[model samples]
Target: MPPPSAPDCYRVPTTPSSGEFRDRGSKFVAVLRPVRSEAEALAVVEEQRLAHPKCNHHCYAYRIGPGTDRWRANDDGEPSGTAGKPILGQIDKEGLSDLIIVVSRYFGGTKLGTSGLITAYREAARLSLLETVLAERVLTSPILLEFGYALMTPVMGALSQLGLEMADQEFTERARIKLEVRQSEREATVKELKAAIAGVYLAEVHDTFVVEGLTVSLPG
Candidate 1:
């Protein structure tokens, strides 16, 4: 596991990808994508259904939010745990979240039974990941800092030392500055801010947001 000092990011697919597998006579096409919410994931599933209206089934699994706090797997008329579970297993195996994998099956007039179905779905999902591109998303926390005018020099020096730029600033009897700190830097940044302000200052850390397009390939 990456330490807290590491980038507070997670792995996710940046674009959609698909893979297929055949079993007996059935064709399974697995579509994998990153989705922001359960609503969006369901919408993608609907789109897949409409695009393949003739398919025998549309089994899927989706995990959303950090830690995969919300998730679901649907067998979609297939035997319990055969289709959806295996597909979800693939997603989990990749340590991915906020993603969906939907496998649409077109009956080829042969039944491979339960175990075969599981293998087909799992293989298709794995293949999708093989063709998928991955990215490390960066998370940012908004912080508000206020300090007495007397300490502007030290505060500015601290900001410079930390390579933190103010998102917004106000100067009056006291000064207030807003910043966007990476989640990984929050604790250390707070400590530095306190040290700089000394006797008089306020630093408020706010909710986090994803840094747009600020992606990297995290090292293992």
Candidate 2:
């Protein structure tokens, strides 16, 4: 309910790490970084700049913090807005944050028109973002829940609806479940879980980190 209180952000990758493509006479180099903050994003840009000093320009954009909604973009030395704006546009279009994309350019002695430059930068940015790994983030409190098959329906249903994560589950005399709770909602959810299960379940609190997002388990 209420969008799970805006869980802390991680990344959901939509593209590969690095890709190279030619646009007109310019050589476009795109690089993707999984970032957690604006500072980290700037640091990455600096690192890239240092590494590629000979490149004509280094343009970048980043999003970080909760919901990964905070974002910034820079075109570096290209046009006033040509490079960074396109890169930022791609990031938003892809619904990605806590991430950064940098396009390194090596001029090839030809001038592409304004529209052509925009298209090239946009394409490079888009393709770079497409080459990354992404994950959903959730704010959670660490707790363990124990239950038996009899309580499965209600307990599982509640957990799923609340976006609780099962850190571990085992079936023995009873089901030993380690569930995560959001820090803001930890006390309330845990209490509700205990009360909801009552005699059918037992819960214990554990020291842990609040992680955001749910990852799909891959099949072997």
**What overall lDDT, based on C-alpha atoms, would model 1 receive against the true structure?**
0.79
**Per-residue lDDT over 169-196 for candidate 2, one digit per residue giving the tens place of the 0 to 100 score:** 8779776677665566666666555544
- For model 1, residues 1-220, the per-residue Cα lDDT tens digits are 3222234787778889999998888899999988989999999899999989999699999988666568999999999999889998988888777789999999998888988999999998889888888776677777776666666777787788668898888888678788887788776666556544443333432223222221111122
Roughly what TM-score does model 2 have, to 2 decimal places?
0.63
* Model 2, runs deviating above 4 Å: 1-11, 14-16, 67-69, 141-180, 183-188, 193-220
Q: What are the C-alpha RMSDs, in order, of all predicted structures?
A: 8.7, 10.2
Candidate 2: how many backbone clashes? 22
Measured on C-alpha atoms, candidate 2 has an lDDT of 0.68
TM-scores for all predictions: 0.77, 0.63
